[model samples]
Target: MKALITGVAGFIGYHLAQRLLVEGVEVYGIDNLNDYYQVTLKKDRLAQLQDKPGFTFQFLDLCDRQGITELFQSHRFEYVVNLAAQAGVRYSIENPHAYVDSNIVGFVNLLEACRHSSIQHLVYASSSSVYGVNPKIPFAVGDNVDHPISLYAASKKANELMAYTYSHLFHLPTTGLRFFTVYGPWGRPDMAYFKFTQAIEAGTPIDVYNFGDMKRDFTYIDDIIEGIVRLLPLAPQLEDVNSLEQSTPQAPYKLYNIGNNNPVALVRFIEVIEAELGKKAQKNFLPMQPGDVPITYADVDDLMRDVGFQPTTSIEEGVARFVQWYRSYYG
Candidate 1:
């Protein structure tokens, strides 16, 4: 079976592609290699997969309609995983058009391609940010996410709506996974965990936002990939639509939260990083930033009930693993 993965040079995309390659699956991966973070890091990721057997890398953008259409026509991909997007809450505030072009327009292009290609299952990444400002302790798929504080979250919500429309009108099977704060080796440099690691290693100060009162359901990359791999073969059947009471129509569409159910405190997360790195962080406490939530807790009951798995990597272990890779990669 051949699978097409967008954003193959990204954190999650790289990990997912690696897993699929090990499973003896033919994989076609694409990435624009934008300078959203560092071009070198993305290129390094591609280098790892470039020579692998049954793996092909294409430097392409999701917004390229004609190019994407040609790709779909040429490769009869059984599965399509859309992981490409302008990924950062704060970055979205400054560049809203980037989110529109990548997350909105690019997504519509994917849906249209899937509609005509007869792809079996289309899995895409959503975000925990979509639960914006909800008073709910553990965010669930059935909860109301109409109020999004950031344009990034709004674009993800738009993706879900667009996928549902395609599923309803064209009978395509689409699944959206709402990922919590994902971190590990080869993670985005812009993320707090990576930044904290860098600052502490450099004997500099790390920014502790919200006065270190924030909580996040930080999920490990391996655990996230495990959940996605399990759901790949299991598409949502139209008859199963009635089982879920959310905004799900009588279509082959589903949404699940793939996250570590435990929410770790911001201070505690930093503590883990420090312990792993064998150094103390000089923290500069600051008030909450705009579009930043106080906490993110994912309710993975639906994911567990269906996929029989949830992210279980502890912050302590995950952070230690990241530290080992960070030192080796940067050394």
Candidate 2:
């Protein structure tokens, strides 16, 4: 099978593409390679897959309508995974337009392309940030996400709505994965784990927002990739019953929370990091910033039922793996 993966140079995209290629799938990947983080790291990820026989790379922006439309026409991809978006909750406060342009506009472009091309399945990245300030523990897919604290979160919620529209009208099979705080080797530098590691190594003060009161379901990258792969083949199915019944549409639409389902406190996460690096961190405690949630936990019941998604890596094990990679890559 052939697949098109957007944001191929991204942390998750790189891992997902690698897995698909190993499974003998033809993978075409595109990324604008925006300077959201280190360009070198993104390039390094691409380098690893450059020699792989079934991998193809395209330097394209999702906002380019003509380019994306032409890409679908040329590639004839059976599946398309949309992962490219302007990421970062805090960054959204300073530049809301970036979120609108990439997350909303770019996503619509991809959806339109899918509708025109008759793709088999469309899976895209959503975020746990959509839960906003809700006090609800173990945020479920059925929960109301109408209140988004950040423009980034709002954009993701919009993506899901848009996907639902296409699924209902065009019968496009769409799946949205509301990923929690994904962390591991080759993770995004803007994430807390990555930033903390960098500061600890440089002997600089790490900014601990919410005064270290935040909590997150820190999921490992490998486990996330595993869940993605498992769900790829199992598209949603639709069944009608005289009485009310749960429906799984075969026309291709579903949403799942791919997470560890365990929320770890910010301070505890830092302690694990310090242990892994063998150094205490200098923290600058600060009040919670705008567009930031105090806690995020996932209810992966749908994911477990559908794809049997189970995360096995503990925080200590995951952070140690990241620290080891950080030293080897940067030192």
**Most accurate candidate by lDDT:** 1
* Model 1 Cα lDDT, one tens digit per residue, 1-331: 9999999999999999999999999999999999999999999988999989999999899999999999998989999999999999999999999999999999999999999997899999999999998898899888889999999999999999898888888889999999999999999999999999999999999999989999999999999999999999998887555235666469998899998999999999999998988899999999999899999999999888997998999998899899999999999
- Per-model RMSD to reference: 1.2, 2.5
lDDT of candidate 1 at residue 49, scale 0 to 100: 92
Of candidate 2, the 10-residue stretch with the lowest lDDT total is: 237-246
- List model 2 lDDT by residue over 122-155, tens digit each: 8899999888988888898878788999999999
**In model 2, what lDDT does residue 221 have?**
96
Q: Provide the overall lDDT of each model, using Cα atoms, as 2-decimal numbers.
A: 0.93, 0.88
Give candidate 1's whole-model lDDT.
0.93
What are the TM-scores, per candidate, against the unseen true structure?
0.98, 0.96
